[model samples]
Target: MADGLLVFDGYCGFCTRSVGWARALDRRGRVEMRPYQEPGVPESIGTDAATCADAVQFRGPDGVRHGGAAAVNALLDTVTGTRVPTTVYRATAGLQERVYRWVADHRGRFPGMTPYCESHPSECAAST
Candidate 1:
């Protein structure tokens, strides 16, 4: 199988949790969650390291690079319940970019998706 690599910010709590959800949603196992900082991953995938730091990125086996929510849409295309949103993205090109950029800019503050440390301060003690 040609697994798609979904790269995200490892240090971000929201990104971490979001990725955990993505993994669960990826029932077909078409996606692999990877931290952008992982050694050789960025180089091997040939994605723009700087841009990936801003938002999620997915590198398909076909050598195409999809970033931001477009990347998310593509990565989750086969997963259940994502077809509509993905189609909306395809229908409206710039919409995904704006939404993805906004979310990326404010990822650290989104409710429920907040850094685990913020909600679980006590648990963070060990890691700190």
Candidate 2:
């Protein structure tokens, strides 16, 4: 079994692509990726739609929930088998949070960023 669950805004192209990259790095299958829009996902994670809509979430093996930059750092730790990312994240949390917020707010503004709903209309129909 995976060490944690990563809940992300699957509709966002950037988010989806980022998750794909993370999966690639997670050769050990340390994390399970899930779209927050999937049925019962947010509730199962003990979070709500609005909370998930705001930022990505990570539920660690210990069942602690982390959001936004913290979640990303935790995921990096799991996938890379090191605490380097966590150290960097903690050292630069303010800037990291700002950057994460900016990226989240403008996820669709980047070129070639097409949301999953557009790329896979059929599969995302219910979520949309």
Candidate 3:
């Protein structure tokens, strides 16, 4: 399978940890995980910083972009080599989106999760 790109917030510990799990699951190295904060990354993906900040982004081998819960489903499908994630996501689209949004909004509140901005104030000062 061609490599797929998973764009996420590097500043969010929760998001970073979640990407770590996804990396582990991608035994075939089929997915490329990139932080949206990286210079020129958002532009390369045909998106902008604000959109990426709002939701996780996935660009599959076919070059189709998926966001939020759809991004997660696409990543899972790529790593697992099954349609199950996509199937389940389609079945519960609304609920999936709501849950994803809630988690994203409260990601910093997760236990032991410290956003990069909080730790490195100077580095993230301009970005925020």
- Say which candidate scores most in TM-score: 2
lDDT of 2 by residue, 1-128 (tens): 89999998868888888887899999999999888877788887899878998999999887989999999999999899999998999899999999999988897775435665566665443664
Candidate 3: worst 10 consecutive residues by lDDT?
119-128
On the 0 to 100 scale, the lDDT of residue 62 in model 2 is 79
Model 1 quality (TM-score): 0.77
lDDT of 3 by residue, 1-128 (tens): 45699988878888877887898999999998877777777877799989999999999887999999999999999999998999999999999999999999998887545654555555443554
lDDT (Cα atoms) of all candidates against the true structure: 0.72, 0.85, 0.85
Error of 3 at 66 (Å): 0.4
Would you estimate the TM-scores of all the predictions?
Answer: 0.77, 0.88, 0.87
Clashing pairs in 2: none
Error of 2 at 81 (Å): 1.2
C-alpha RMSD for every candidate: 5.2, 2.0, 3.0
Q: In model 1, where is the ten-residue run with the lowest total lDDT? A: 119-128
